[model samples]
Target: MSQEIQNISPIKQRILQFIAELGRSKREFYSLTGISRGTLESKTGITEDTLTKLFTAFPDLSPIWVFTGKGEKLQSQQNETSPLFTVNENIEDKLLNIIAQKDSEIKALAEEIGKLKQEIIQLKELLLK
Candidate 1:
């Protein structure tokens, strides 16, 4: 609702609105959007890559509304009933969930790797002593 947000591109404003609707903080917005925290905070306008990521992550969101603010915030109810749309939505949700799980796994692995590296350094120091 700030003037800065209002002055930015419509897409960015819509993104902000979407995040607000979800009742998420900036940190959670970054997590949900899979956008880097620094980039989200620093960029005044949304990039094509970020937009693509946003749409891909939330298929139920209507791009028309996000880009032009002319349609419903969500996809039309007619599309929701279609078998193909439902299947695509299901696939996207599953994919996003899988990506989130993988990210957590990757973070845990990175921490373990760092610990192992430190232990190896300590062991090497002891051996030389």
Candidate 2:
């Protein structure tokens, strides 16, 4: 929001404080959100409106906890008692899908190679006849 932050809106101030409390930097937030500098600037400037927009855009974000500083850091309530943050479960699913596709491709290539080898052997025998 505001460069000095003194001129920042309430919502922007809370967001800034949340980032600080989370031990995260602006660059890290930028990478996660993929929002442009101009959009972020404009959004932060309109703190009240931006809070709703941001929460709507990032449902997984814990806006109340982030702003009020009273609850968990994460948006979604997690059941796991693990202290460390982990990668999203979807990542594992995506990796498994890719491995399966690659395995199928490998099997098809092996079959084609086997057919080519048989053809080469047959041609060699015909020529030697």
- In order, the Cα lDDT scores of the candidates are 0.77, 0.64
Query: Considering only N, C-alpha and C atoms within 3 Å, which residue pairs clash in candidate 1?
Result: none
lDDT of 1 by residue, 1-129 (tens): 376565667677777788889888878878877887855444466688888778888898888888888768888542543332334467778777778879999999999999999999999999999
The alpha-carbon RMSD values of the candidates against the true structure, listed in the order shown, are 15.3, 16.3
Best by lDDT: 1
90, model 2: CA deviation in Å?
A: 33
List the candidates' TM-scores in order. Answer: 0.53, 0.36
TM-score of 2: 0.36
lDDT (Cα, tens digit) per residue for candidate 2, span 81-123: 7523246647777678778879999999999999999999999
For candidate 1, the per-residue lDDT at 62 reads: 88
The residue pairs in collision within model 2 are none
In model 1, the worst 10-residue window by lDDT is 77-86
Error of 2 at 67 (Å): 6.7
